[model samples]
Target: MPLLFIQRALMIAAVVSGLSACSLRSSPPSFTASGFVADQGVMRVWRIDDGQQRPLVLMSVYSPYSGPGTISTLYEYQNGVLYQIKRTDADGDRDSIQLRFTVNGTVSFMQRQLATQRQKLSNDDIALYQYQARRILEVSDALNVGRVRLLQGHWQQGEVKLCNGEVVKPGFDKQAENWIARRTTNNHQPVSLAWLDGPEGRELLLVANDDFCRWEPTKDTL
Candidate 1:
């Protein structure tokens, strides 16, 4: 079987096991991060939740190894109901979408931008966006329950310096560690690394020379 297929199978199993475990917790963390592999890219998700496990905000960054471009989406919920969704593409066209929903799940505001043009979204498009927002929330909840974490940091001398300035060695497998080492070998500029930590194991998500911190969303910004 393919590696991606195996990973997906393991993730599903984790989610199933976690359903029982999550119910036992009296209080869950207010913030969490997780990610998964999409068709041709990797998606890193950050979530902020109310103490009762109701998500307040969820943001995801999808970076394709080869294809169109990177896309970032943000979902905001009010009283456990999704109220806003924003998506941006890092392509030349700079396509973007923003939608705001009312408490009764009706769309209150919607806009789509492509380069210099602004367009109105059809009812079908609005429905699709709403569907995607809910689906992302479900996936994020499963990943959080499964103890899957997404971590990103700056790579320096075989150690990772996290956004908060904490430097530590992550528990990555030999293959992943080797890949990082190989990529950073003789590189002068700083490299950014993103990876997944899950009950199954650690998986490398990205290693690029880009400055990830500049664009990453913080609690205040989110």
Candidate 2:
């Protein structure tokens, strides 16, 4: 199966397992948006968005063997903030916790395990670390475009170069043309798509440093 398919299956499994246990009189927690909660040494869920009642973040800490160890630290991004759900497994039982905090103007998720229940944090300590999530949408929006190829580089004989510049050898790829165009145009700050001649056919290129014009590519036939 495809990697994405496998990953999705795993995620679904985790979600189902997490919500599996509930008595008839009790209602499972509703997750309005993605968030976290701090349960009784079992698991924690944190919500990053306001006005949402469900868990946007979930953490469970578990150590399954005779010696002390940690399995994984899971992070989920909701409402443009990264939240953490940590699990601690010790002896035969597992203790999990979820937290969302703000530091240095950034949101962070954390989980820690203690040798004993007495080591758990106090209410004041939890309050001190409690905070709202900052916006992470900025980063995603910034990197929306994948990659760029400055100037029109030729892939002739495994060599590449900026248009009107000396040639530099580079790797070749049949599927990389689209990626190259997006990256190059964005980096050059071209308001519109650039055109260029590609290894396969005609294409677009951008040159912001110069005329800020597009480069069109045509296949040369003998």
RMSD of each: 3.9, 22.2
- For candidate 2, lDDT tens digit of each residue in 27-67? 32322111111111111111222344222443222222123
Candidate 2 lDDT trough over 10 residues, lowest sum: 139-148
Residue pair clashes in candidate 1: none
Let me know the TM-score candidate 1 reaches against the reference structure: 0.86
Which stretches of candidate 2 lie above 4 Å from their native place? 1-70, 90-97, 102-115, 118-222
lDDT of 1 by residue, 82-101 (tens): 99999998774789999999
lDDT over C-alpha atoms for residue 94 of model 2: 50
For every model shown, the clashing-pair count is: 0, 44
Q: Would you give me the overall lDDT of model 1?
A: 0.78
TM-score of each: 0.86, 0.20
lDDT of each: 0.78, 0.31
